[model samples]
Target: MKSSTFKYSMLTVGIAASLGIVSTANAAESAAASTPTIDNVATATYKIGAIAQTPVQSNKVTVNITQSAAFSLTAKNDDGNATDDYNRSAIVTPKGRVAFNHTLTNSGNVEDTYTLSLAQGGTIPGSTQDASSYDLAATNVTYTVYNADGTVKKATTVTGTDFQNTNIVLKPNEHADILISAKTVGNVGGNSQNLTLSAASTFFTNSDTTKATLTNINNSITKVPVFKITSKVSSTLNLNDPSSKVTYTITVRNDETASYAANANNIIVFNGLPEGLRLADQPNLSVSNNATIVPGNEGKGSSSADDSVRVTLLNLEPGQEATITFDVQKDQNETLTNPKNVINHASVSLDLGENQVIYDSTDGTDPKQNTNVFYPAGDDSEVTDGTTNTTTGSDSAAPLVANQRALSIVSPTKKEIPTSTTESTQVTHSVILSNTGKEVEGDKPGEVKFTITPNANNKVTVVTGSVELIYDADNNPNTPNAVYTITRDVNGDNDLSTAVPKNGAPPWTGMAPNSIVTITYKVESNKAVIDTTETTTVSLVLGGQDVPTLGERIAKNTTTVKGLKLVKEQALNENCAASTTLTFTQADVAASPGNCIVYKITAFNDFSNADARFTFNDLVINDTTARFNNKAQVLTTSTSPAFTIRLAEVADANVLPTDNTYGATASSTAVSGTVTNLAPQKYAAMVFAVKINPDGTTTP
Candidate 1:
């Protein structure tokens, strides 16, 4: 065999060098460095015969390395986490910033650049996505990535899913830490949101064959303190007492939700009493455990010069409650409109700082436009402890009546009237109308109505009214101060102004405050249910200019109307109808036998119902001459045929059945008739003529 010049050619082949890592790398950890080529050649020299022959060698084998791309991303925690992890946790303040720490590593043999992105409720590619307790949407969320070393890579903060094409360049086996920040909006400090951060390798990004990416998650929850306020008040002021004060009750409570019930300290409650009102007494305050009230300069009491009241509570815990009650009286010096109202507004500061207000009038109300409620007089049912209670809006208390316009009746008398059975009697009730509120002027004056509610029977009803108005120009209750007296007749009108002439100026339309109006009522009360209230409502108007609200309910006198009673009786005549000259008399008279004797029977119908359809229908009547049917005893009675009962006509407004003929033959022994449709309060008669067949006690 010829071993002539058997030499290996110089070989050059591309080969992969020491790969850094097959797994992902994170911040503070090394990654696979640049791709290094393996260059080596195999050399062999063999002489032909161990002599000085020419050396031959095979071509040297060579290898070159190619780049392998790899990178990783991880989320870090603020609680001193030693190494980066896949998940991070944090608590976010509402309307404030919450940042999540993260790290990115280029775990590859070659240097690589990366692009960062943040996604909410998103999934990692090529893996099964998962959900947490609270999955928050990345939409509407904004974040900015800042270098952990205080270096600003991208000056612009990115929002939502758009990463703005920002890039992060890193050396092989190098890593970088970044902070992702976001602000939570409109959350009441009780909810949570999950976020994800992803780092894509730009070296082989979107490559046709190979791609590398890392994704990690962060969970954030909202934490803050919240509270609820409640307020309540009575609709009307207590008028019986001279103090004339209105009371209000207010309560403050921590939020009911567990996450929102954070501890609060040094709570301050301020209630600004409205104009035309003054504090009357000391305020009453009560609280739960771990809380106490701090009094203001008024010492839990009220001052005439103080326009507002303040109370402070210390160390109010979650779900704890505190209550306060105060009274306000009308200021006599403050002059206001006649039918106006006063409103009180309140605010609650969490830590005795006005800027840290937890509940206020403008909490849920419109900022651009302020709206308040005005409750009508005598309809004050909307006062809730807090604005979230009985009423809808916050800040304003239920409207309290501030008008000094009031009227009432005094010296009511009770009487009974006696009358005959057939006659109608009249009853009267008199009272002095006293004005205790503001002046009742001509242009803005209202009327005190005198109403007469009947007893549901037609016996007694309201007929008219007579008013004797006495005007006092000087606004005094003394007798001599009333300078003018006018009388007017109000016929059948109710709860309206009296039609009286004020020196021929139509009617007197004005009355000063504390004046007296003497009005006499002509009402008929039949039954015993005394309709005592004779005042009208507060809605009043004068020539449609100024609407007035003036009257308070006042008691009126009691009247009773007696019912009618009638009785009638008829006696036996003892004689025939022929010999007696009197028509209907209870007297003894003689009559000849064979004379005409008559018998009568009447059908009377009297329906007393108030219904007009009440009547007597299909009425039938019958009469017999049985007294003359027997044989005559000695000077006693007449025998057969002495008297015959037949249909005979008798004078009756409501005629007998069928044209007054009683429905019987002329010579019949009995009489019968039918009266159809006999109305109420009417009567019908059935009569018969008898032939005294020469049969009378004396004649026979």
Candidate 2:
């Protein structure tokens, strides 16, 4: 273990650095040990020519390319390119094939030469990637190749079963070309494809053989398309009048930002309209776009580009709007006053390109929507004029009827006198009024104010009676003249008396046209009549004024001059001597309905007390000139004095004319028997004697 010091210099350092590693080189130069000078030195050794196994890792390459045209064409190539490692990686080449020898020999027997013929029929590859076929025949032997998998990759020929000394002839080989082309139709991805060639045969050495015919096969290529649509509409619509037209605007926009290359064809539609409200077919609609519209886009043809259709849309696409206008007319004959509140079917719709889109048909802006829109005009139409009929109750007080203009008296022609101390009058009246204008159910009746005009010397007095009114016209504000008094009929068994008010309104007040009212009374003369001469004073009144005289009346003296007379006579028993003639003359010539006059006559008895009682004769004579003479006879007798007789009724032939037969009846009776030669106007006579003397012995 001796240590030696080594010298180091700059020059030595430069030389050593230039030599790259001096220390390592010197260590390899000398390794000598004293014992046998065997070097026990570390030597770096490598197995340069040593038989050693080293694993060689294979490198694989992959590409993520889509099935492009170039990739598909490479996959369709039949023969691979020998220059490229990927195409010619494992190519099979034949240097030469072993030939089979066939011979036929015979030692003795016929000294002739035998000839053998071999037939070769086979398929050969037209290109490196195509399949081949081969068939060989020698003498009585034959061979064939069958591809069970249907793809043939290699060429093969079979020899006969045996070979002998024979001259053989063989047929020529055959070649054919195969076609391999690629096209893409759809999306493709993932791993490369391996094309395989298969073979099968019954007379071959092997059953079948397969080789990778092709690799990295690509799929067909194509392009796809997409579409989008949007729709919008106006915010407000006005359907104020059913007869007025309404309009709406709807716009649909079709957009394309999709990966697909195809253009879009679109349809727009809407639905849900109120009942009876709908759009007219072939509606006015227009469509536009950024590009010039094709004929199909303008609804010219059935291509996908067709854009517009005459229809309403139930649903709208986003951002698209439509406006539709239509005219409406309301039913004028509707009976309901508020028919506008009723809803009807109305809709705006679009027929979109896609048949799957849905639409709405509900109404939104109808004119009948608000109460103010359906206000009514005033019109009161009626069928007939209104009238009032009054059926008065027994205990009811007088009623007031409005709008009366006339009156009617129910009682017959009458006059009043002061004959009795107290007398009452009862009257009834019925009044009717026709409406001159439009009549309402609760309208007030017109007012009727009946005023009696008294005589000029005295005030008009209310005698009695009241009127019944059907309607309260007196207090009605609707009528200008509302108060009326109608005299109504009174009911009673005995004579019913109604007091006439001295100061109240008249019963026949406010009478209308054709209206009637009456006043009746029991009148008596205050003084006795002298010789049937009676007179009193009364004043008739109307409309608060006294009625003037009608015509000249007959004087009291003139009535007296037309004296009472007997116009006819009838005969009793004709027993009176020289029958007195019955005379006749006109009585007070008073006017009657038939213009006839009444008459009075006095009959006298002239017969004195004689042996036979006087018999007065009475007779009836048809002729006015005929007198009661001896033709008169006795009929009956009476004891009382002669009474007045009523003669025939008479009429002034020239002035008081009447029907020929007078409307009258006549009768008479006689008194007790007392005298003979009775007046011709009287009847029958008889005599009787005292009955006292017969009891004494002498009967007279």
The 0-to-1 C-alpha lDDT of every candidate, in the order given, reads 0.42, 0.21
lDDT of 2 by residue, 90-125 (tens): 211111011111111111121222222222222222
User: In model 1, how large is the Cα lDDT of residue 334?
Assistant: 51
Each candidate's root-mean-square deviation in Å?
45.0, 71.6
Candidate 1, 1-700: lDDT as tens digits: 0000001111111112132223223233222232222211111111111121112221221111222244556565654443434443365444444676666655445656777766655432222332223222333333333443545444344454455344777765566666665644443344455666666665555431133455666656554444445554543564445376656665565544344345667776766665555566554444444454443333222444444567665455665556666776655555323313444555565532212233444233424221111111121122322222322222334445544455555666554432211123344556566666565633232344444344444444444433334455454555343322223325433333433544544355566666665555455433322223222211122233222332324444545322111111111223544345424211111233434433344443333333233343344443332334331221112433233333333345334323444453332233345555555455555444443333332223
Best by TM-score: 1
TM-score of candidate 1 to 2 decimals: 0.32
